[model samples]
Target: MNRPAPVELCHKNMRFLITHNPTDSTLNSFIEVLKRYGVTTVVRVCDSTYDKAPLEKDGITVVDWPFDDGAPPPNKLVDDWLTLLKKKFQEDPGCCVAVHCVAGLGRAPVLVALALIESGMKYEDAIQLIRQKRRGAINSKQLTYLEKYRSKQRLRFKDPHTHKNKCCIM
Candidate 1:
């Protein structure tokens, strides 16, 4: 089965490339394309068994955060994961970080959405923007988490009596 190619998520300011896991046939091409995009680092959010040694040898820094598909990492891991991406962006302003899971639709976009939220974008807008870039970017379960996260934020700051309607319904 032929999989679709990678999609570049953002271009106006900070850049991120989102794509599915590369197979043996697509590995070399993936590296070349990422280089063309000025991607100096890769965040591998697929299973640990998916080898990325080739990418590492190509001089692109790759960080692994393996987990099953259709699920987000633990809350603590999510925090640490975002921290690592933040540091990478700080180290090189021009860097394009490529993030991927098996299909780049579910898990990869969740991370991208969270990063955008951290970068000061509203969760709704961030998800919309990502969806524009790559259709079906986040699955329903992932969207639920984003909504839950947003609701938690509102709960932490807003008065329940005044903002109960604005908080998460769940």
Candidate 2:
């Protein structure tokens, strides 16, 4: 079977691989493709649940943040997603995060765009970037959300030795 490959969106130290959900038959191939991109985490935003055991067995972390189809994620979920990205990058600079929501067009791309915006790219630029790479990405509602999104303050991290807090800007 010919499986569609994931689209990669990389900006500086942040990298995201967005694709459709894998089925029982495609899971192995999906994992291979993810490995090629050095993906360390998989974020599933769709309502459908899959067996994460295979992905986890390959040493990839799986995060579930499900929401209704065709709707923007809750603010708290967005915040948490960003936080996870920040921490993941801090721990492994070269690792990539794989995101998917059924078709890899809507929610997955929205989250990636938000991350790009937080990483200092303008919202328009972010949307354009994702659409360029992963055709038919954000929908009208998601695009509106991206247009109005104001990035939250950068998460603070403490220096282990100095015991001082510092903002780790993406």
Top candidate, metric TM-score: 2
Candidate 1 Cα errors over 4 Å, as ranges: 11-13, 48-50, 150-170
Model 1 per-residue lDDT tens digits across residues 37-90: 988788888875346788778788888887778876678768766677657665
lDDT of 1: 0.75
**Sequence-dependent TM-score of model 1:** 0.81
lDDT, candidate 2, 58-151, per-residue tens: 9988899988777888989998998998899878764799999898889888988888888778888998899888877888998888888897
Best by lDDT: 2
Candidate 2 residue spans exceeding 4 A from truth: 1-4, 153-170
**Which stretch of 10 consecutive residues in model 1 shows the poorest summed lDDT?**
151-160
